[model samples]
Target: MKILVIVPAFNEEEGLVKVAEQFHGINDVDVLIINDCSKDATSEVGRKLGFNVIDLPCNLGIGGAVQTGYKYAYDNGYDIAIQVDGDGQHNPAYIKDLIKPIKEGRADLVIGSRYLKKEGFQSTFLRRVGINYFSNLIYLLQKKRITDPTSGFRACNRRVIELFSARYPNDYPEPESIVYLLRNNYKTEEVPVVMNERFGGESSINSFKSIYYMIKVTLAIVIDNMRKIGLT
Candidate 1:
């Protein structure tokens, strides 16, 4: 199966270089960097490294940047598309493991979970609290246990690529997209993988943004669940 690694970058030139290094000479895998109109040298760095780069005319946040990758994957006929953050938190070493269930047809979406093994960089206490909150919320709504619902490290097959290309949430998409897939009866699974601290660049989410993220994602999940229930 043809695989594409979609890295949604925003001013990640420093970290992106390290992330790109892991993909070097990996056979049967292609990398695409979606430069989200970063003020930094992300685009130039991607071009310099010879990876496929798509520069959005304006900043569209992570959701829009990732959707752009899905569209590219669908149009280019990729069998699997994996989302690895440009911040260098996600490890490329686990890319094969991530795509395994998808390639075997066991799942349509596979999330690389940091909590399953409970190893590596386990995020901050407050952040883990938020992640667990979403996990429970999703289970309450869908009865499925997604250990790390907010994990951006995930892989999806062609079907999901097409679906996301056509319609994806605009913000905090990882958890919400899982709910959408489950509500519609798509198979989703999680695997044990280790995540690392960012190689460079500050996180977009601060204390203030963390509070907003929690509220916004919670509302998004509830509303999506209600909409799905209404449709059913």
Candidate 2:
């Protein structure tokens, strides 16, 4: 039951060391930092902390970086893979619970949701509104509701790792990937978990960028749904 926690890092120098340190103590879990060609010293910080790091040649966005980790997990025969953001928004203390369902053969994907009971790190109003919009969009197509469609903290078993390794959504992937998973009949479960604010650094998406992000992801999800129905 080897577990690989893939940390996608981009310009997250402040949290790199702490994030690695927090997870290093987990039993049977190893940390792999996929540096998305960060402008800051994210890779160097990982190297200095003696953590495994993969430096991408160029920025592949969150989805590509995570796909790299899934590929590594698949090729290296990891039993499970978990995506942990390098920004430290996710707490490692919940790692055991997140992986429990997967370890017990209950689910293929287990997402840590912040809005399960509306507890912990609710994010800003606009972000919450955006998350709700995506949630509704997903429900419209899949007939299932996701409390936190934008949650980056998630775990998946070997089957999902293999599938995602071959293909995955690139830009703004969290929500779109869910559509892909459900469309393919993969089991996805959500667990309510309290998340923390980022350890440091600002978000890549701002108010202005979020508008474009919303439109792009909405289109992506619809297009994915179309593909599932052979409409595309």
Candidate 3:
């Protein structure tokens, strides 16, 4: 299978090399770095490492950056597309575990979750609270449980690649996108994977913005669910 690893980076020059090193000597997998108009040398760093790089004209946030990678995968005829954040929190070593279910035709989307084993960097207490809130919200809407709805470390088959490429959220999208797929009857699964603190750069979401994130994402998911039922 032709697998493409999509790393969406924004001002992550310091951690790009370390992230790339993890993929070294891995045969038959291509990595694409989506530089989301970073102010730093993210694009240059990606090219210097010999990875395919796409530099957007403007910052599109995480959701848009990831959607750009999905579009590239769709156009390039990649069979599987994996999303590993450029922040370096996600471990590329567990990539095999992520794509396994897809290869076996058991799942359309597989999310690498940190809560499954209660291992790795579990994030801040406030962030964990937000994650739990979304988990319950999604379950209430879909009757399905997604332990880590905010996890960006995930893999998808061509079907999901097509879905996301055509229509994706603009901001704070992970939770809403999962619900969108579930409403459409796509199979989603989670596999336990250890994560780490950011290798470099600061997170875009801070304590102050967490509140906005919660409100925006909650509304987006609810509206998406309503749309799926023709209530919007």
Candidate 4:
């Protein structure tokens, strides 16, 4: 199958080159970097590494950047698309694991879960709490347990690509996307994977921003659920 690895980047110049290099020699996988109008040399680094780089004219946040990559994958006839963070947090070795279920036609979407199987790194306490809360909420909504709703390291087949390309959440869409897949009756699963800490560059969301993000994302999920149930 043709696997398109979409790396959504925003000011990820420090790690973009290395990240692209790691995927350069991988078989059956083509890397595409969506440079979200970064102020740094993200696009330049991607080009230097000989990657298929799509430079957006403006910053579109994480959700828009990712959707742009999905649109490209869908238009180009890619059978599978994997979302790999450009921040060096995601390990490319687990790419096969993420695609296994989809390739077997057992799942439409696969998430790389950090909490699966008591191994390697764990998220911050506060972040873990938030993850559990959202996971439970999605379980209640979909009647299926989801352990990792915020994992960006995921793989999807053409069906998911078409869905997100048509309509996707603008900000912090990971949680909401889970709902989207569940609502449409698409099979979703999480595979165990390790995530490294950011290798460089400051995080976009600090403590205050994280708190605000949590509140905003929670409300968005609630509203989306209501809409899905024909209550809103």
Error of 1 at 52 (Å): 0.8
lDDT of 1 by residue, 154-227 (tens): 99999999999999987778989999999999999999999998888777677888889889988888888898
Candidate 3 deviant stretches above 4 angstroms: none
**Structure candidate 3, residue pairs in collision:** none
| Candidate ordering by TM-score (highest first) | 3, 1, 2, 4
Error of 2 at 1 (Å): 0.4
lDDT of each: 0.91, 0.89, 0.93, 0.86
Q: Write the per-residue lDDT of candidate 4 for residues 1-232, one digit (tens) a residue.
A: 8889999998898887568656756878988999989999988888887888999998899999999999999999999999998888888999989999998999999999988884666767777877888899898887888888888899999999988888888877899889878887899999999888776665665677667777898887778778877998
Candidate no. 2 TM-score = 0.96
Candidate 1 segments exceeding 4 Å error: none
Identify the leading candidate in terms of TM-score.
Answer: 3
lDDT string, candidate 3, 1-232, tens digits: 8999999999999889778777788877899999999999999999998889999999999989999999999999999999998978888889999999999999999999999998989999989999999999999999999999999999999999999999999777899999999999999999999999889987888987889989998988999899878999
Candidate 2's C-alpha runs over 4 A off are: none
Candidate 4 TM-score, true structure as reference: 0.94
Q: Could you tell me the TM-score of candidate 3?
A: 0.97
